[model samples]
Target: MKKSQLAVQLYTLRDYLKTAGAVDRAFARIREIGYEAVQISGVAAPLAAVKKAADDNGLVICATHAATPDLLGNRAKVADELAMLGCKHTAFSCVSDFQIIDRGAVLEFAGEMEKAAQELNQHGLTFSYHNHNMEFGKIDGEYILDLIYANAPHMLAEIDTYWVQYGGCDPAEWIEKYAGRQILFHLKDFRPLFFTATTAPVGTGNLKWQEIIPAAEKAGAQWFIVEQDSCAKNPFDSLKDSYDYLTKNFVR
Candidate 1:
């Protein structure tokens, strides 16, 4: 991917974006950190202010993690907000109270996502689904993530690397599997914690980025988004570290 296609998922800086003034400053810092684009999520500021912040910093609103409820029940409203931000893509973050063991629940959610994708298509916007480790569970022996992609053909894949690995699957293989249907890739790294793993800046953790980046490129990805759900240091520093690694090696 080109450096221009690299972006920061703003959810990583959620705490810093709680106000319009904060959004403006945070976005400026993001631009200074060398990110050309951002995925809007978890920002408490008004949409107008968010747009202004991006514009003021010369950052593109590449995509967003739109709320699941809004994607399922009010696609038009989501579309309007995306249009206002001049972003053409948005992803359903996750489901609520989802029971992975229930096959019916999985299929039901897939159908709903499909309907939402259709509605989003009408608005000339792409709809995608963001996954977490829970999606790897088996329902009647089929992976829930596989089922979601099969049942909801219209929804594009927004694969999160750390979550895929956490789910006990190979991240590169999954990214290649989606091929043409996937366009957004969340690059999150994880380091071993007490009993599990915790978020770390890309390339600093144990993830195999050398393999993942090539796989994502071959999958026709349009955005390579850097994200760390939680950081051990200042979030902006974490963002910069990830950006430095990506631009130096992966981005062209």
Candidate 2:
């Protein structure tokens, strides 16, 4: 089995990670909390400075959630930025527009991604799309999400288990369906409120991590990123709880 490391998405700490100095302190705290890897996003520092912080603290940037405009606009340039951070795994994170409802818009996006994936592959980088519940609506007989992946074979799937559940699908089933294409898996827990689902730490909520973790491992996932968009307590403490849970239980 390929080793899967537990990584925390920096976006989970976005409120605390803005400037270069803030990023440095956050990385230091992450290391102190025993997280050895991170998935970068929303950091304002230059790529060199970000790389330096990770290197200085012995943190590995396993993947990143870069801007969608940057990825679809100039993939080669994005590839250069990723290379600078010694990162080969990346995803657009989410779609900001409702154009995914239009077939033509999806096709256009897929075409751009095909070329971008090719460019990224040439640079030894992998590209993927991270989903939210909005992607659940199906087009034709297939999901817009599945259609996008089918259109670009080189583009990988970075499945978020919680979103899959929120979208009314079994996350493990989707994980198995995209077996070989997943490069990074987002590990988040979900709990039902009155009419909606809310984010929780990895194991403290309703997610079946045992099933999800093994499924992702079977699918060749390299990093399992713990991400909780909102937390009830201090966000860092919530992250620490998740990090400790995964380390003690799943990660090898």
Candidate 3:
């Protein structure tokens, strides 16, 4: 399948979502830019309003990213809200604060995630975990991400390419290795520095998008959400440039 056929994660337009009437307008602009699907984050509008905006703008809410609190404690309510907005997947973008401490804490957090995944499965919705750099830390000679996946093999992951690279791992290799376990990815590019990295538009970074995109597709990734945490210019312009660059050059 074509990369353009994939969805855009609306968190990429977080600035717009914060503005008045911007959520509605952003969906319209997303459609205008040839995106038919979106993964919602920080959706401030009512479920009905969000659904209406998506429908009016010809966009499909394929998945949603929520806080761990929203997913673990208020899952049923959150699931209902997502269902009302036509979302099929609910992804936890970050873990609870307590889970940030050490390896043991991470394992404990993984157990909680497993339970949450089972709960979400019962609700007829798929659950996913979105990764950040910290998840790549080594624990007992294995990455924390590996431990989480092992603990809950059924739970899906939305891997962030930039974070994968930031953690000193190859995102494409993981895509191939974890095929069928990762259903989505945040396809942000990163520029490698001496000890840190900087994010840039897709092809402008050292992410090896040429290899990663195809590997993700082969791994059954249904959505590739282009995300840049910080942009030199406005977020919308950054997204537009990234979208154009990907469609015109990177995607085949």
Candidate 1 global CA lDDT score:
0.91
Deviation from native of the Cα of residue 110 in model 2, angstroms: 1.4
- On lDDT, the leading prediction is 1
**Candidate 1: TM-score?**
0.98
TM-score of each: 0.98, 0.95, 0.92
* Root-mean-square deviation per candidate: 1.0, 1.6, 2.0
Q: Any residue pairs clashing in model 2, and if so which?
A: none
On residues 141-164, what C-alpha lDDT tens digit does candidate 3 reach at each position? 888888888887668988889988
Expressed as tens digits, the lDDT of each residue in 158-189 for candidate 1 is: 99999998989999999988989887889999
User: 89, model 1: CA deviation in Å?
Assistant: 0.2
Global lDDT of model 2: 0.84
Ranking by lDDT: 1, 2, 3
Candidate 3 segments exceeding 4 Å error? 96-100, 193-195, 250-252
The segments of candidate 1 whose C-alpha lies over 4 angstroms from its true place after superposition are 97-99
Local distance difference test, candidate 3: 0.78
